[model samples]
Target: MDLLKTPAFAAHVESLLKEHHTPGVSIAIVHDDTFSSAAFGKSVISSDAGSEERDCTPDTLFDIASCSKSLTAAAVALLVEDDVNFPNVKWDSKMSDLLPEDFVLEKDEYTRDVTIEDILSHRSGLPSHDSVYMGTKAKRPDTAKSITRKLRHLPLAKPIRSSHMYCNLMFTVATHLIETLTDKTFSEFLQERIFAPLNLTSTFLQPSSVPPADRDSRLACGYSYRESTSTYHAIPVFDTPEDQGAGSIITSVNDYIVYVHALMTHAPPFTQAIQKALVTPRFALPEYNDDRERLQSSTLIGLGWEIFYYRGHRVVQHDGSISGLTSTHFFLPARNFAAVILCNGDAGYPAVAALVRELIDQTLGVEPSQRLDWPEIFTRGRGVRGEAESEDADGEQKNEEEKAPSSIDTAGAKDMAELTLADQPEKERGSEEKYIPPPFPTSDLPLDRFTGEYHHAGYDSFVVGVRASPEGGEALFIDAADRCMGFGIALEFVCRAEAGGDASSPSPSEVKFLAYLTDVDECETEILEAVFVVDGDDRTDAGGKIGKARRLGINLDEDIEGLIWFERV
Candidate 1:
C-alpha cells in the first residue's frame, strides 16, 4: 500500500523546531500496520564549546512520560484474562498477600478500599502531589513509602467512581499491587505479560535497564528551553521505581508503533475488551476552546487516553511530558492511520496534534477544513455592519458624518442622551450621585481550615499537604515520598463566589484546581462546584460529600485532563 505522506509534514516539522526552538524531534506514521518515520535537529544542544550536532533518528529513545499508563493498563488486562478476580479484589490487598509483608499500605483505609479498576481509570482520587523527585533525595525507596503512609491521614476529594482525578499515587499503588499478585515487579510483569508477547524489545520501564551500548546511539537526550538564554539545555533524567507504572517508561517511535498496533488490532482478549473500555468516554471534562480549528468542540477523556472527534472522525491519543521532554502519539482507528511524535525538548503538544490531523487528512484524501479566524472575522464583521455612528444634519443637502468628534465624550452615560432624551437615564435634579461598592461577606475561616493533608480513597500513596505560607498566608504543597514539592507543583485551587458577586452572602463556594507542570506550565485544570450532599456519616464538612464531585467539564488546556474529582477530604 502506498502510504500517503503529508505535503507539509517536513516543512511543518522544520517550522515547529524553529518556532518552538526545540532541540530534537522523532516522529513516526503508521498505516495498515506499516510504519514510516522522520527526525530533525540535535538531541543534545551545543554549549559554549563547539560540539557535534546530535541528529535525532527514527530509533531515538524518549521518556514517554504518562504514556506509560496505557502500557500498564494493557498489563492489567492480561491479568484479568488470567482469571485474576478484578472486581472482587480490594485495593488495600496486603502486599504480603502477593509480595513481601514489608511492602505495606501506609493508610490502612486507603489500602483497604482501593481496587484495580480504580487505579486503571484514575478514579483513585489521589492528588498528583509529589515534589521530592525534583530534589536531591528523590533516589530513596523510602520516598515512595513515605508518600504511601501519608495516604491514610489524607482525605478523599471524591468517592470511588465519583469522578476521574489523575493520580500518580494510584499507578504506583497499582504497580505494587501487580507485584503482589504476580510475584513480579511492575517492569517484570510488563516484560513477561505484554512486551515479550508483542515482541516490543526496545520498550522498557527503566532507562538504566536498556543496554549501555544503545544509550548514546539510540537514546535521545532530554532537554528544556532556557528562556533567559533563548536556547535549549539538557535536563537530568531520574527514575523512581514507584512511579514506574505511572510515567517512567522510555521507548522509541518504532517500538511505540508496535504498542499502538497492539491497541488497534486487540492482540487477544485484551485486544477486544481493553480497547472497548479505553475509547468509551468515562468522564466529561470541561469544554475546551483553543486556537486550533481541529480541537474545538471535539476533545474528551477516555480511560487512559484522549478521545477526539474532528471532522466526524474518532481519534484516540495521548501526550506525555516530563521535565525536559514532551511526547505525543495519536491514532484514528476508523481511518486506519496513526502518528507518533517525540521531542527531546519542551516543544508542547499542540504542534503534535496539528501534525497528526494534517497527516490524517492527507492519507484519507480529505480536504483540510479552514479554521475560524476570530480576529479577522470580527474585523471584517465590524467593517460591514458598521460601529455605533453619529449623524449630524443641516437644513439642506445634509451629508452623513463618517466619524465622531473626540471631544464629545460619552463616559458614564447610560444611553446616547445627545441623540434622544427618552433613551437616556433621568438625571437627579441638584443631587450628587454616589457610587457604593457592593457588600459581600468574606470567609474568616482561617486558611488553616483549608490547610490540611488530603487523601484519595483510590490511591494509597498520594497525599496533598497544604501548609501555611512563610509570608503569613497559606500555600498548597504536595508530599509524594516524604518530601514536599511546593504549591502549584501538581494542583492549585481558585476560589470563586456562588452567586456572581455575592461573596458575603455565606453562599456555597466553588473551587477550581489548576494542575501545572514541574516547570510551572499549566496542564489540565478542573473546576468543582461546592454542593451540599449526604456523606457516609450524613454530615457536611468543609470539603463537601465525595459523591457529588462529578466531572462536570475537561481538556480546557493543551494537555489532557486526566482524572479530576473533588471532596472535602
Candidate 2:
C-alpha cells in the first residue's frame, strides 16, 4: 500500500518537482516483499534569497553517479568468487594478462584482446574519451593505475569486440583491476567488499569518504539551474577520488534500498552464480539507443547492468550523472520489483526519469491510459527542457515561433573547474573582453609563434597563449587546464591551409584556428578545430623566422579521428 503514501503518489512527485526546476527527490520502492519510501523537496537549494533550506530525507547522501557501475560490477563479481585471490581472474581474464603495464590498448590487437568480459560488457572499443578525464586534477594526478595507463594514448572508436562503447575509461579499468587483483583500494575494496557485506551504512567511497558527522547532516546538496537567474545554485561536493571504478559511489535512499534489496532478495553477496554472471545478455543497445516510447525493448548490456524490456517486465536498470546528482537504479527480475530514485537538481533527470516511469506504472498494475506522461513529455518545449512552454488546455503560453531550438543544457555540468565557473554573473562571464577576433581578415604566423606547451598523450597538456582582443588585437587563447569545464578557450583565426582549397593556393606553412567550444554558462557552441603544424626541416630557424610552433591539431573527441596530434611541449 505504499505507492508513495498515495495522495495520487504524492501529487505525482510534486508535479515532477514543479516540472523540473527540481529542488529535490528521494523515492525507493520494493513492491511484493513490500518496502516503499519517499522524500520530496529541498536538500539544500540556496542561491541566496535568505539561504537555509535543507529537507530531502530518507537518509539523504547521493552521488551514485554512473550508478557506481553496479558496485563496480558487484566488485568484479567478488573477484569472480575469490578463487584464492583471483587465481587467474576470470570474466574472460586477458586484459593483456590482467595488467601488463596497465592494460595497454590502441591495438596490439586491442592490446592482446581486451577482457574482464571486455570491460564489463561495454565491449571495449572505448569511446567516451570524456575529454580525457576532464581537467585531470588541474595539473596532473590521475590514478586508477594512471587512468589505466591512459589507455595507451586513446583512439579506438570500435573494433575489439566491436560495439557498446559506453566507457568511463573502462570503469577506470575496473579501478585498475580491483587494485591489481585485490591488493585492495578501490576504496578499500568497496569498503570491505560491497559496503561491509551489504549493511551499507549510508555507503561511501567518496564525498571524501563521508564521515565528519555524516558529512554535514547526511550529505545531499547538489544542484544547478541558472537559466539567466531563475536561480537554484548550490553544486559543490565533487570528490571523485579518480573515479574509482567509474563514477564514485556515495549512496542513500536508505543506503540504496539495501543495495536494491540485495539485488531483489537474492541477498548474500547476490550469489546465484553472482546473479547469472551479473545478468548475462552482453551487447545489442544501438537501435538509436532504443527507447521507443519507453517500453524499452531488448536493449541489453549486462555486467554493469542495463538489461531492458519494461512492459514485458525483465527490466534491470541503471542511470546516473555526477555533478549535481541524478540517479535511478530500478530492478524487476520478473517483478520481484525494486526502485530507488534519488535526485538533486541539474534539472533532476526529468524528475528522476519520471519517477522511474511512475514507479514502474505503480508496481505493474499499469493502466492509467497506459502510463507515460513523463511530466508531459519532459515539460513540452522551452526547446525541450529549460522549460517555459507547456500550457495550453486553454491556459495559453506556447508559441515563441512554436519554440524548440535552444538545446545546450549540460545538466549540472562540472567535471572540474568548479561548476562551470560558479554561479555566473561577473557581467556574464567569458572575460578578457571575450577575446574573439580574427574571423579571417587574413594574417599568418605571429600570434606569439603559436605560444607554448601542447602535448596530448590522452589529453594532458594545454597552454597556447595571447588574449586581449575584443578587437584591441592579439587573440587566440585556450588555457583548458581543467579542460572545457574551466572554459577559457577562445582562439578564432579560422583557416590558412585546407578548408575548401585553392583561393590562390600558396598560404601553406600551416595555420588554421577556430575554437568556440562554450560552456561558459551555455548557449551551445562546439566549433574547435586548431591545427598549427610545421614539423619538417623544423620549418625555419637558422634565423629564417616563423619557428616555435611544431605540431598541434585538435578534435577533442568528436567521436575521435583525424586530429588529437598535440606534441610540441
Candidate 3:
C-alpha cells in the first residue's frame, strides 16, 4: 500500500532518538483503517563489536502504564452494556461483598461511598498517596489493602467532583468494583469482553505470565536516569497482578493500535456509550506553560483520555510512562488518523504528540498555523544553550548578546509600553498611590520554634527550616525528600495573612510558603505554594500528631509537579 508518508517522519524518528538519547523506538501510524508500523534504532547498546543492537519490531511489547486506563474504561463500558444493573451500581460497594470479609476498606466511610463512575473519572477523592505501593514488603493484595486502610485517615483535598486529580487508587478501586459486579477478576473481565472481541491477542494484563522466550523476544526493557552517574540504566517494571487495572498492562505497538482504532471508531458494543464518555471534559488542567495561547483554552479530559486542541480540531489522546518506557497514543477522529510511538527510554511525550500532530496534518493536508518549532523553540528562544549574553559587554560580545535578548526585550518592552499608555495621565497618575505594603505582626514563637520535622499520613514527610536572610527577616524553607521543595519571603507571607485571615484571632506565627524555581535555561519560572501551619500540641507516646494541617491548594507552574511523598522508614 502506497499511503503517503509524512515528510517529517524519518527526520522526526532520527531526531527523537538523538534528542531523547533513546536506544530504540517502535512507531505505528494508522490512517483510514489501514496500518503502517516500523521500528528504529536498537533496543540495547553494547560495549563490544560482537554484540549487536537489538532491533525494535512491530511486535515489540511495551509497558503501557496508564494507557491501560483506556482499556479498563472500555471494559467497564462493555459491562455496563451487558447488564442494566451496572449504571445503577453505587460508589459505596464493599469489597467484602465481592471477595472475602478481610478485604481492605471494611470500615472507611469514604471508601464505602466511592462508586464506579467516581473511580473511572478519578474523582473518588483519593489522593495519589503512592508510598504504600513503593515501600511495602506486602504483596499486591496486602499493598492494595494498606492503601485502602490509609485512605480512611487521609483527608480529602477537594470535594468529590470539584476537580480532577490524576490518581492510581481510584482505578484500583474500580478494579475491585468490577470484580464484585461480574464475579470475575478485572483481567478476566477485560479478556472475555474487550480484548478477545477485538482480536487483540498479543495484549494482556500480566507481563511475567508470557513465556520467557516470548517475553525476551517482544518485551521492551524499561530505563531511568542515574543522577549520580549522569547516564541511563534499566529500571525494573512494577510486578503486580492487582495493578492490572491501574498500571499492569503490556502490549505491542500493533496491538495498541487496535485499541486506539477501537477508541477512534467507537467499534463494537462500545460504539455509543464509549464515545460519549471519551469526549466529556471532566476538569480543566492548569496552564501547561507561559504560552498563553495553549493555557487559555480548557482541554477536556474523559474518563482515561485527554482531549487536546490541535489545528482547531479536538484530538483525544493519552501518554503512558513506566520506569524506563514511555508511550503516546493520539487519534484525530475528524481526520481518521492516529499515531502511536513506543520507546524503551524515558523520552518526553510532548515531542511525540507534536510529531503525531504534524504527521496527521501532513497526511490530511490540514495546515496548522500555530505549530511550534520544537527543539529550536526550546534552544534559541529559551536560551537552553547557556549562550545568553550579559547586559555589559564589548562590541563583539554586545552584538552576540543582542542577537537573542534584543528580540525578547523588544517584544517585552512593546507590551509594557502598551500597558503604560493604557494607564496614563488622563487618569491623574500622581493621585494614584502605589500599592502599600503590609507590616508583619509581632510573634512570641522564635522562627526556630516553627522549624521542625512534620509528617502527613497521606502526603509525605516535610521539614520546616529557617535561615537568616541578609534582608533581616528569616527565609523559611520547606524541604521534602531532601529537595528544597518550597520557600517564602517574609513580606509575601505577611501579605497573604493580612488578606485572608480570621480578623479577630489569626495566628501570626502561621504563614504561607511559595517556592519559585527557574527552568534549566532560566527562560521560565515555576511556582508551588502551600500554607504553613504551626502545631502547638505536645508530642505523644504514639507517633506525635502535631497540629492538623492540610494542603489547602497547589498551583504548579509546570506540568510535571514531582510532588512525591516520602515513605515511613
Whole-model lDDT per candidate: 0.52, 0.67, 0.52
Model 1: per-residue Cα lDDT over 41-135, one tens digit each: 77766554344457787788888887777777666666655545654343233333443343334445545555556656655554444432322
How far residue 235's Cα lies from its native spot in candidate 3, in Å, is 1.6
Q: Give the TM-score of candidate 2.
A: 0.36
* Least accurate 10 contiguous residues by lDDT in model 2: 386-395
lDDT, residue 321, candidate 2: 67
Clashes of 3: 4
Per-residue alpha-carbon lDDT of candidate 3 for residues 1-569, written as tens digits (9 for 90 to 100): 33323545656676767776566777787888999888776665552223334677878777787777777777766655654666544323333344344233323554455555666766655545433342212212333344444454444554555556566765665676577668887778888887888898888787775568867666766654433334555443435654557678888888888888887888874685666765676655543343322422445557777776755777777777654677777788887888788787764444454456556556667545645555444323222111111111110112243333232333332232223222322211112221111112223324443455555454334455565443355555442211111112121242224223333333322345444322111012233444544322321113322233322333321112333222212
lDDT-better candidate, 1 vs 3 = 3
What are the clash counts of all predictions, listed in order? 26, 1, 4
Q: For candidate 2, give the lDDT.
A: 0.67
Error of 3 at 329 (Å): 1.2
The whole-model C-alpha lDDT of candidate 1 against the native structure comes to 0.52
Which of 2 and 3 is the better model by lDDT? 2
lDDT of 3: 0.52
